[model samples]
Target: MRVVTATNAVKDERQAGGLVVEVIETTSLGDRSYLVSDGEVAVVIDPQRDVDRVIAVAGRLGVRIALVLDTHVHNDYVSGGLELARLTGAEYGLAAADEVPFERRPLADGDVVQLSPRMRVRALATPGHTFHHLSYALEGAEGPVGVFTGGSLLFGTTGRTDLLGQQHSEELARHQHASAQKLASMLPDGAQIWPTHGFGSFCSATQATGDSATLGEQKWINPALTLAEGDFVEQTLAGLDAYPAYYAHMGVQNTTGPEPLDLREPVRAEPEELRSRLDHGEWVVDLRSRKAYVVSHLAGTVSLGLDGPMVTWLGWMIDWGAPITLLGESREEVGAAQRELARIGIDKFAGAAAGTPEELAADRSQLRSTPTATFSDLAAALAGDSDGFPAPEVVLDVRTNKEFAASHITGAVHIPLYELKDRLGEAPAGAVWVHCGSGYRATAATSLLEAAGRTVVLVDDTFDAAAAAGVPMTEPGESSSSS
Candidate 1:
């Protein structure tokens, strides 16, 4: 077996058993899009936002993209399956039970998608990451060659099960454990494992250090794979991070499909056009890093730094149903930002603002800035009930379930920011107060709640402020109703 990393700067490839598997790593999300072929036909797995990358790679390799499969309905990035399939006239596939909007071939457990005489994919139903999660085992001349794990099995940890629902945790954990054991038992020791998400991914606690690892290595070192079923469940549930607020929207977008956005011809908007859209309720998503955003940003733009998990945050913070205009430092930056957001299924881009700062600045009414709250000011607000502050019952903790369970303000309703949309109806209509572990997520929650026609007071202070103010604190894993 030999591996050759594709050098196009946009695609990656490795060869085994005379089969070439090209991986298109999205610059926007770090999510990998794969093209597996044995020269004549190809199968793409979890393609990123851009179809051009896959099309170009397939053209270069002299192969056709015959089938497109999404491991599951993605929450962090949009799947390019629909776009790629439409462009190439390939069959799109989803797990048999998946209820996505597009036409798809139903892939079931043990079903094989044959690419060529020497290459094929055996679909393994590995639910729990998402209800319809599927992992693919690549069989080549070398036998069971590699496995595309998607988000079900990461390098060290497994996918967070809490994203689906709190009530589903125990059942999900049980299924996740079963899936891990099933994969472990079936895959050969030397079979390589490739995952869609890597480091810096919010989906996994930790990604594999290298791009790919072996099943044998995972058996010995992967915590989720190595632990007893019950322990695996406990550790995964315990180490869970706060689910990003954008996850729910991303799920719906992935299932329903995003409207196509063409990347080849950059859609440049004039300053007046940008302002008009903003006036009409379109949001300006500034996709620069936090430092760049802080230094300067278009007025009234929400910053989901390009350097961080921008797409994930964008899907969480921005209204998926709303139109978005992008502002980046350069054309490449804008395209990259667009690709990242597209991965999570947000394709409703009106256009990108083009030209020099001076050109954009000529229209003063068009530009606004992000509001910044100091740590001290946030602390002051949390410490004492200022004039007109709402009562304790009105306070809402908008952090993740894990974060709220870890520590939270007394009498605050526990509403993980990701679940805010579904749970918002449960919140009392008047004077709802919200806070997160820090000010960032809280600000995002406040913005959404405000947009929903609810009056919200944002608590941007640190957790210690609650303690200093004699507000009772509940440790994580304790019932919110407990004192």
Candidate 2:
């Protein structure tokens, strides 16, 4: 584990003694899959549901995939390890303690998976991210090169412990602490740490910082290493936030052997079918920019733009296994969204339509638009003048609880975007203006509110621009405005 620069640039490939470790990033899901090869043979770790990417990498490197391993039963994207193994005629591996229906090369603590004469992976039971999580230390003839930590030890923090359940969180936190310490002691200080989660995934207890790190570097920055076990457990639990609701299905899908991904184009939908799906309350996702969506869209279609975290938020907001139809500006856009959804096990679509809002609409009557605003506009509105824009009866902040607690518009109603689906009744009636940290979540919130028959305006501006726009802000527990 050579010390790379302290900058955020993460190299897609790193060199070991005689091996090349290629990083396959799923930025949308905020996870990384690795293809570690000894030139002639390779081992893929923590692949996503779309195994094609891993296969493509292996083919490009001209290496035969000899083994596919999972650090744990993932709770984020469905694991592609099983399917990748089956496709490549490679042995699938995981903790022997994990009870999965599929047959795998069950690996226990200290099990060695020899990849070549000079390269091998030594499995170490590193439970706490899950009950039976295992981290793989990639060893070269000289010594260990790096460790594939999965969710056990991230760059700056550990994986969240509550995904299994709150009842087990404290106990797991203790295990997580011990696990991180164990890795620190077993591996050399210079061994590079390759983690599967924590780039931006909710799997991390807190957002992990830094793009790369060594065991020596992490010992100074990672809470699991710096804090006492009890302090680490308490801090880890307190830092946990709401993860995507779709996570509840991933572990089960992984353990049962996820179905091979279906990247084939979905059934082409007509305007009439699109309207019917919307009418019946099926999820009709609009894959355009929020700016375009605000100007016009099919009524009731949710705004999960392709340019943002569409997959994570859509997977979080939609009812699992619900009929979903995609509406995009082009076939490519629809295809791209479909591929991303597949990574999270959203394999089937009710239908998909590619066209402009006008073309997708059966009639002009089916089209609708919402107003857009900025905090400056809201500031003016509060002063009884808004350049003819209607003054909002309610200022709705759709940012997360932590964000709202840190700072928000004075007198704004707080409802996180995820909760808006069920808490629509809690929103005050009349003209409402919604916003989030950025315009993305706010755009989604506006469409949701509008579909529920509320008059909504989207604040399509960054939150940092609020104070500069002369909007009064307040922090929670403060009696007076901050600025």
Candidate 3:
């Protein structure tokens, strides 16, 4: 199940010996950065590209920033570690073996950095997510409080080993298994487990559930702790799936030093200019909710709503450094998208506009709409009920392969969202009806299909509704159903 937390950014001040570990969650990206403090001194771990949040937390707690560290050269988002350290004049450290162009305090396994008389951090080599990954063990006057397991040992799963390459995936899986064993052997059962990935991060081998966990708790549930090394390696490798294509750029950005964040509002784009940009094949993304965009939006503008994984989808599909123009109902929406984009190293924007579709479009002709429906509506359409809309010629399932394999509408064409850009033409010719696990991914696919001049309907409802709606369902290897 997808872990749904109430808020994206939350803090957990529970720590031993007056230490405060503030969890700075980037819910949009399914990752967390930490601001661990011992009353007067603070240290940050795996910070995002926007370092302002970390700085604000430190200021609120009235702690002097003593050090900033990266658990690993991140593969999901640009690391804000260097910038945060530079801004605060704190020691910036990473695994010593990671070759980079910038200067950094190199840390080796078993190395300890004194934060205060009562608090210090110990580095342990745990190479699963990356070759030089490190997990920091935070020690206090009482003893070990917790360990910052970047991507090594997550709450219930370990980080995927295939991010490096398929050739090294199994090899890395072995190291990952060994690393988790090492951590379990060294740390006590009560030690809190603070991981940077696995909340919902694609870096995780599987979707991890749980907001907080102790080593004791994980021992029973975490695959890394429960399975034998050989079994763990096989299970982890088998469970891997496609991650966002934007992940290809994140590691390089982190290692080479990411560009300084730029969240400044872009120059406003007039209606004519927005039309010209769209005509020329530039990305004009509408930041409105899919529910709103499907009803009415500028023709050709794709719906990557600020309400969903906008950055991940936009970054994955758009050409790197493409001239992106954001359209939202208000400046606040545009501003929010800008910060989220910046987190993934999308620093350049062609322009931006904030207004309703009617306000942004030069003429009513420029606005277009795609029909939206729920599973019941689709079921009626399939049954040829005159009260429902026309029967769709095609039903497109745009969820991941694993999601489709588990259970999906019978006879629906399967095309994973990430692969849609390259395989658009492969979609069968007809008025298409599309759905995903939820409406989020389907909306993205619907926008793409509409932009490609295909007649499409967005199934904007939960997958659970399909069975109840009498929509025929089947899994892999099952007999074919009528299209």
Candidate 4:
């Protein structure tokens, strides 16, 4: 078997009679996912949080993705496995015993999957980092080649086994040791190791020094593998940094399927066609970063700030089934934006505004503008008294539950903007005041709540301001009406 190294170093290419592997690097999160294929059929591995890159790669290669295999349910970020499967109509597969929420082909230990005549994958249950983790060994003409070690083993360290529960500390360590030893003994010395996470990822205690490694080398230098199982378990659990607050939620979301995002459909509109569609009351989503959006953006376009948490924000703001248009810096950017949005289950792309900003601006009558609020304005609004308003009882805090729990205005109703729609019944009706950690999300929430026929007020205040204003706040463990 011949091993080929794939990294985020380049773009798509057609090689070996259309058998190609493309690595799409999502720089926003410094994450990489691979698309492996042999012309007629393809499979995606450890899909990034965004599904757009995979879709674009598949489209360019003229191949249909038949399956999506996630190395494991990730903790650092959300998974796009389900989203990719939905978009490509491919079957999603996970380790046989995985407890994730979506239906998938349960890949068992020692199960061999054929991608083509020459390319095949053998599933090896490697469950140190996570109970359901699996690594695939690639086989070709000569023998077994590289293994895709999701989080089980990296260049320098092994996947942390402390995540599941404190009680499993000993079990995880023992399992991890046995699994690593098993892999080392079974694979040839020359077999390559490809890990899902490299540096800057919290999954591995020790960051990878190189992108890839050999099984023989890892066996000698990897601390976890060299130690006794008991010591290995204890050491792995001791030095772990605090897991990110979002990990728990992300885990559950991956297991139970995240709610769908509302992405606009891709439109190829002429000036007239674009204008007619806009007149018919379709929403325009500008999927650019906050910085790019601030410098300049289209008129009548709502800024979703396609930067951090792109899919999640889009899912919360855009309408799932509405006709929409995109305003991106380039065609590739627009396409990437579309695919990422789709992964979260948003598939409506009405088309992009086809020309330069000035060209699209030729018809002034077709445009409207959304003004951004300043921090000062937001503070003033929050501090202002609402006693004279028709309904003074409604106060909505839009931050995460943890952020809200640490400290928040007492008696304020809590409805995270992301979970706002489903939890709408929890919101008090009439003249509701909404505030997030800052004003950005509050503006979006205000617009949504108002559209739902509730009178809403946008509060401009940082969390500190609320505290200083003598607004009664809730401590982390304290139960309140909001919780």
Candidate 3 lDDT score relative to the true structure: 0.88
Please list the residue runs of candidate 4 whose C-alpha ends up more than 4 Å from where it truly belongs after superposition: 1-7, 10-21, 27-30, 259-261, 264-483
lDDT of 1: 0.70
Each model's lDDT: 0.70, 0.89, 0.88, 0.66
Report the candidate with higher TM-score, 2 versus 4: 2
RMSD values for the candidates in order, in angstroms, are 6.6, 2.7, 2.7, 10.0
Best by lDDT: 2
lDDT of 3 at 471: 90
Steric collisions counted per model:
12, 0, 0, 17
C-alpha root-mean-square deviation, candidate 2: 2.7
How much does candidate 2 score in TM-score?
0.96
Candidate 2, residues 283-340, lDDT tens digits: the string is 9999999989988899999999988889999998888888999999999999999889
lDDT of 1 by residue, 1-483 (tens): 344344344324444577777766664454676777887898889886667778888889899889898899887776678878888899998888888677888999999977777888899999878888999998986678888888877776677687788888767877888888889899988877777875456777544465567888888887767788888888777776665666766677678876675555347887777667655656766665544544444555555556655676666655556778787777788877766665665555778874434455547644433334433433444566444544333677776665666687656777776667567688865676666665556655665565465665666566666666566567765656622
Judged by lDDT relative to the true structure, which candidate is superior, 1 or 2? Answer: 2
Q: Residues 414-441, candidate 4, lDDT per residue (tens digit)?
A: 7777777557677866667777886656
Clashing pairs in 3: none
lDDT of 3 by residue, 1-483 (tens): 011121353433444477777788888898988888878998899999999988888888799999999999998999999998889999999999999999899999999999999889999999988899999999988878889999999988999999998899999999998999899999999888889998778899999987788888989999888999899998999988888888898999999998788788999999999989988878999999988988899888888999888988898888788899999999999999999999998878999999999999988898898888989989888888625554688999988878887888888898998889789999999889999988998998988888889988889999999999989888667865532
